[model samples]
Target chain A: MVEPLVELKGVSKSFGSKKILDNVDLKIYPGDALGVIGPSGTGKSTILRIIAGLLKPDAGEVYIQGQKRQGTIEEGEPSLGVGMVFQQSALFDSLTVDENIGFALYRYSKLPPKKIRELVERKLEIVGLPGTGDLYPAELSGGMRKKVSLARAIITDPNNPDNAPCMILYDEPTAGLDPIASTRIENLIHDLLFKQGLCRAYAIVTHQASTIRLTTERIIFIYQGKIQWDGKREEAYVSTHPLLKQFFSGSIEGPIP
Target chain B: MNRILSSSGLWSWIQRSWAAILLSGKAIFFLITRKLDFSSSLEQMMAVGPASLLIALVTASVIGMIFTIQVAREFLQLGAGSAVGGILAIALARELCPVMMAVVVAGRVGSAFAAEIGTMKVTEQIDALYMLNTDPIEYLVIPRLVACCIMVPALSILALFTGLTGGLIVAQMYGIADTVYLDSIYNFLDVWDILSGPIKGVVFGALIAIIGCSWGLTTRGGAKGVGQSTTAAVVTSLLAIFVSDLFLSWLMFQGLGQGATMIGQ
Candidate 1:
């Protein structure tokens, strides 16, 4: 059997007396696209962060492939090959497009600036944002910033094949875009998956059906931090999971409150 | 009901407060523990150095000009004009340099620190740093603290030098008597005079870093929180500088004596 690229086993997290995640488990196989959907603040983004090693779980284990977690970030844990594009796009405003895109490379890679620039430009083109190198983040539109961030995430992935997580986690990749822009982004997400011959194990946490339908091969319904339903995207409508029914209908009387 | 509320309720609140303090302490302690080798800190210092030089130069020059113009006017009107150079040296070297530079830099660099860190905190980029086995404080705060501690004083020294030169230009251009000018100047400042200013610079740097980083780390209200923290860092740092300046001045000279006094003669 092929090894799963990323897996979460019985993971749980809590703040004070409130439990956010309980006995949650998930897996993404190499070259598989996973979409996580649920109500706002349902810990969908939290899961993405956990996978990225951003948040520590209170119980259970998170394994990147099969490695047992051993240390905090202070330990300089090797970059788990997982790159994340944040919900806010979190691009550095002080940095220009070239600098922002080249940030991680400059820090971690010994590549010359010219090489990094070339790589950055190519990554931007892959994300449908060509020739936007000198612009500061504030000058660009929100959608453009998100694309730059995506380019930043993907640029080094092709180079660091051995060390980094092949699975990328996108936190609400299309959250604030207009319908047209969202569709554009949705298409970009698909194109990126196939373009680089990257592993298919990306987990995109989003609320838009258009994005989910376009980008994911499988959909995992997360509600109140536990996995409520897991199946192929085509099985979404037929599945009688009450949470999905309530969430898909976009109703007021649901388990979400 | 009253009995239950009296003990456990108060006790719980105390425990919560203690926990919060401990958590913040852990953040600081952990950052301190994970510090890179001195050579790495040295490298960061080297990088942050020349990048910040130009701003310090421009600000110090302007401050010098203003300080000289006003000081020359006061001494001139009082028939002590020739003494303008000495007064300028004493005031600019001892107080104005550190104070003005602190306020200027606190406005420029301090706000930038708060905004950058605050965004990282909100977006979980900081947490991302943690996951990658990077201590956010070690990766972020140490370099900032080291850089600012080095730069703030560096800027202050420049300001004092320029302000005193500015006074010299005023005295010479205005035709103050060279005899009184030199006498008053020599009478006022000595090696110890200049010594006090750089000391203030060190304190100012610490104040700016502590307030800016603390506010940035605690930011929670999203964009508004980042903005508010930026504003708070500048206001609190500048105010703290003024208050501390007074206390430092008192302890250095006036508190030890009635006022400024004779040095070893």
Candidate 2:
């Protein structure tokens, strides 16, 4: 078995008196595409935040490449590279699309501005958003903004190969989009993760069944702060886990509510 | 019973403000120990400095003219017309330019910082910065802090000169002789007096930046929160300026005894 690149062991989180996550364990191996499916506010995004070190788990440990995650930016870099595609795109409104895509490069790479722009254009092309370098986020449609945001996350730091993100976390990779736009995004994710062969592992938190079917090989169903079901994508449809069936069937009358 | 109820609210507010101050201090400390983002700082300077130049100049000019109109007429009637220039210079340098310019900036630049950062906070842009391995304090707050510290002092100096020009114009129209007006300012305006306003400006600038950014970082509850933070930031910055001004004025001028020695007769 390939060594797990990222792991969450006995993880838990709470806000005020409400528990958000409880004793959750998860693992992602090299080259794995995992789908985390759940009802809204069921700690899917929270899990991604913990893995990225943006938020600390109230209990339990997060490990990257079998090493314990370190706290604080001053600590040496973690063993695994992590990138996040935010649900809202979250592209800096003040920056142009190219500037947004090239931000990490500009901040952390030694590449000249000309080279950065060239690389940004390349990423834009990869996302099927060619010639959008000059446009701002506000000028772009919702779908375009989402694609540009993904480009920003996955744009490699050519100068520092070490900074290249291998683990990508997609929060709602296709939300608030027309079906055609969502298909485009789903194709882009497929191309980036498998066709281009850039990423090692990915976890997508999304409601779209097609997105899960097309992008992920493994899936986990989370409900009420616990992993209620875990299995391969093939098993998702056949497994008669009532909650999973309810979710997959889009049926209102089931064990889910 | 009323005191008990209000004290809890007051105490929580104090704790919140204290946390913000501590965060600002940490951001400032990061300035000393880390590589400063000069590009961002320069951008903020352009926003808080030259961009604010027109309004600061206009406000100073109006205040200077008003001071001269009110005082020059009365002083000339009393045979102390020459004293009008010195008094205007003193008041503008010691108090008017710094306080008034700070008020303008608190309204404009400070509110802007709070609004921008507050929106960023609520929209998860700040969280995105963190996910990018960018420290918000280092990337955001320090640049604004450094920009305000540099720009506000520079603006205060410009405001001082503009105010003097306004006073000179008003004095000429009020029939005070140029020689009398110029001579009085030359004789009475000590280097120490002139230095005081810009010095105060540096302090005021830091207060505005810290308070604005702090309130912004502390913002919650979404769009409504951003609005509330912007209003509170401006109000807090203004109050801070006035209260600090009293202490700064007393400390800078105490035991200086008119500061006449700095300008030999």
Candidate 3:
């Protein structure tokens, strides 16, 4: 059996009095397009943050490429790079799109300015935002900022292949976009996976149905701080799990509370 | 209820103060290791130094003129007109210039640091920096610290000179000769007295930078959090300046009877 790129064994996390993730065991293998769906205020995004090494679990362990992570990313990074696209696009308002995209490279890599600019331009083109490099985050629309952040997430230094993210964790990539914009982002996610092959796997936390159906192959339904159901995308639609049924139906009454 | 609220508030202040101290320690470690970002430091220096020069100079000058005006009349009435410039110089160097410059910067640049970083924190841009493998301390806090440490002293020194010049002009206006004013300053102001302003400035600058950055990094909620952090940072910085000034003054000028002896002479 192929080894999973990332695994969480009995992981748990809490904020203040509220437990966000409760003994959550999860795994993501190469080539996986996973969707994490849940009611609002559940720990859907928390899972992604844990996987990305941005947040530490209150209990249990996280394994990246089968090696147990000893501490948060600040202490030591995983063997594989994990890129995250934040829900709000989180671009540095002070930086231009090119500066934002080329931030990691400019800070970490020995690549010259011209080479970095070329790479940033290429990533911009890949994300369908060519010639928008000079614009700041404030100048870009919400969708455009999301695309810029995507470009930033995928822009890697050719000189440092180890720094390239093997897994991408997206937090509500289509949360506030219009339908057309959401579709565009969903299609771009597919193109990145299938065409560009920028990352080996990705997990998206989203509430949009179109995003779940169009971009994910595997699905997990989280409620009450635990994964209530895990199955293939087709199984998610027909599963008899009451939590999934209630969630998909958008009912006021459910086991979620 | 009031006791509980006040205790919680005190605890929060202690927590913030501790965080700022840790941040300052880390910044000092980074500085000693020579892991400085020169570009960002230069940018911050421009913001903290030259951009604030006009206001600092203006405030210092007015303060000097007012002091001379107040002292010249009293001293001349007592046949001690020659001592007016000396007293003004001592006050400007040992207290006014450093404290006033710090207060101005704590209000202006310190507040900006908190608001900007607080916004970044709430917007997740600080997290984005972490995701990009950039330590926010190294990227954001260190440069600001370095700028304040270097520029605040420089600004205080300039303000001291401006205040002295203003005092000299006012002394001349009060019928005191320029030579007498200059002689009085030379007699009263020693090397340590001249250096005190910059020394106090360095301490106040570190306080302002560390407090502002700490408030920002700990900011929660959203826009409201940013505003609160900004306000708290400035208030904390000002309080720190005044309290530290008291200790510094005592340490630097304790048991000094030179002024009394000079007056007897």
Clashing pairs in 3: none
* Candidate 3, residue B61: how far the Cα is off, in Å: 0.5
Best by DockQ: 3
* lDDT by residue for model 2 (B191-253), tens: 988889889999999999998998898888888999988998898899999999999998988
- Top candidate when judged by lDDT against the true structure: 3
Error of 3 at B239 (Å): 0.9
Q: How does residue A27 of candidate 3 score in lDDT? A: 90
Give the C-alpha miss distance for residue A1 in model 2, angstroms.
3.3
Better candidate number, 1 or 2, judged by lDDT: 2
Those runs of model 2 whose alpha carbons end farther than 4 Å from true positions after fitting are A72-79, B1-16, B73-78, B259-265
**Ranking of all predicted structures according to DockQ, beginning with the best and ending with the worst:** 3, 2, 1
- Give the alpha carbon lDDT tens digit for every residue of B1-265 in model 3: 7678577777677778898988888888878875688999999999999999999999999999999999999989988887888888899999999999999999999999999999999988988888898888889999999899988889899988899899999998999999888888889889999899999999999999999998999888989889989999999999999999999999988884475445423
**Which is the leading candidate under TM-score?**
3
**Global local distance difference test of model 1:** 0.74
lDDT by residue for model 3 (A9-82), tens: 99999999999999999999999999999889889999988887878899989987777877766554643588
Instruction: Output DockQ, candidate 3.
Output: 0.65
